[model samples]
Target: MNITTIGFDADDTLWHNERFYVLTQERFADLLADYTDRASLDARLQAAERRNIGHYGYGIKGFVLSMIETAVDVTDARVPAAVIRRILEIGQEMLRHPIELLPDAHKTVAAMAASRHRLVLITKGDLLDQERKLAESGLWEYFDAVEIVSEKSAAVYRRIFNRHGDGPERAMMVGNSMKSDVLPAIEAGAWAVHVPFELVWALESAPAPTGHERYRVLDGLGGLKALVDWIG
Candidate 1:
């Protein structure tokens, strides 16, 4: 069966997203070493997610802001104002960093474009951040449509499919998050391909399906071409 349209999840799907977060988180840990333990800092930041969900929305920039808030709350030291400034600078750097598409992301997307398949990018994050990443990544041109959603759920996928897909059988979702990318897409009646990443966040965990015809898991985006070949 030929895939009429293909959907992709941003973040860890096509590029090195969380690794940048990891790098900055390490710096944050080291900066707060005097006032708090690394685990403690992480816990506080996690707590801030609940607090800021309504205010800042979601994405890396918001997360870095939460880290700053957490730091200020924990330390209560004006001396660390400089540290806060540095953290903000890091966030800016993260946003501006050039696109680092995963090994075969560009090639795969180009190939798919050549095949005349409708390529849509379905990512959930801060609207500005999502747009900026796509614009800078040289990938925006490859997609026919781009959906920046608030969360990755069955309902969200269904809505996107209804709007853009060729029913369930002909549209496929490819991404790195099992919870978001695979399960929800499969549940929405679209085929799913999981490109496993090394670091899977706790918030993004859902049970793996037992035996689903529409589900697949792979090592990385580099394997996507093979999957396309197999499917085609």
Candidate 2:
């Protein structure tokens, strides 16, 4: 009940994210339909994403590269330049995609800030893209600090919470990804709140810690303020 620092994940947590990737993926499948079936193409793309996460990290840039890799693999490196260009365009479109805040995202963040809790954005993705989204969200002023990490892990959570707040013991991480946001934060001894987002990305998926003392789940961001107050 002594939580002070509240950390939030940007994508899908504050706004719509995975939908763009999924839509682009559908587009990728369409482009590769001549060379491979949807199942084969999806599997190849997912494998490419998983393998390339370390090399490319998380973002549309990496996703575009994975699509290109999948295209090349499916077509034996014979995918036309036009298709490649279109894939690049899709990535740009995603990058340019406007920020559309989730239900109650704005109000919840405002309320949290009003309560004088130190809110921080702790998310993973391309630096520029994350920054752009945060800027567009118009909620940037609420956060006392922001962290766009290349990856999320227990150590990363520990370091971020320690630097931004009173350490992980008094920090709370809130996000849709159990893998990236909830689990690691809890492992770092921080309270973690899971707010499930639609179209959960494969890499961010993990089993929920249903009974962890510091773990809580909300059906939506609207419940966040009350949850924090109740915790206090």
Q: Pick the candidate with the highest TM-score.
A: 2
Clashes of each: 0, 0
The digit string of per-residue lDDT tens for model 1 on 56-135 reads: 76687788878888888888755367888888888888878787888888988988877888888998778988898898
Clashing pairs in 2: none
Expressed as tens digits, the lDDT of each residue in 1-232 for candidate 2 is 4889999999899999988888888888898888999998888899999999999999999999999998999999899999999999999999999999999999999999999999999989899999999999999999999999999999999998889889999999999999999999999999999999868878778898888999999999999988888888
Candidate 1's C-alpha runs over 4 A off are 76-79
Query: Which parts of model 2 have CA positions greater than 4 angstroms off?
Result: none
lDDT of each: 0.83, 0.92
TM-score to true structure, per model: 0.90, 0.98
RMSD, every candidate, angstroms: 2.0, 0.8
Which run of 10 residues does model 1 get worst, by summed lDDT? 72-81
For candidate 1, give the lDDT.
Answer: 0.83
lDDT of 2: 0.92
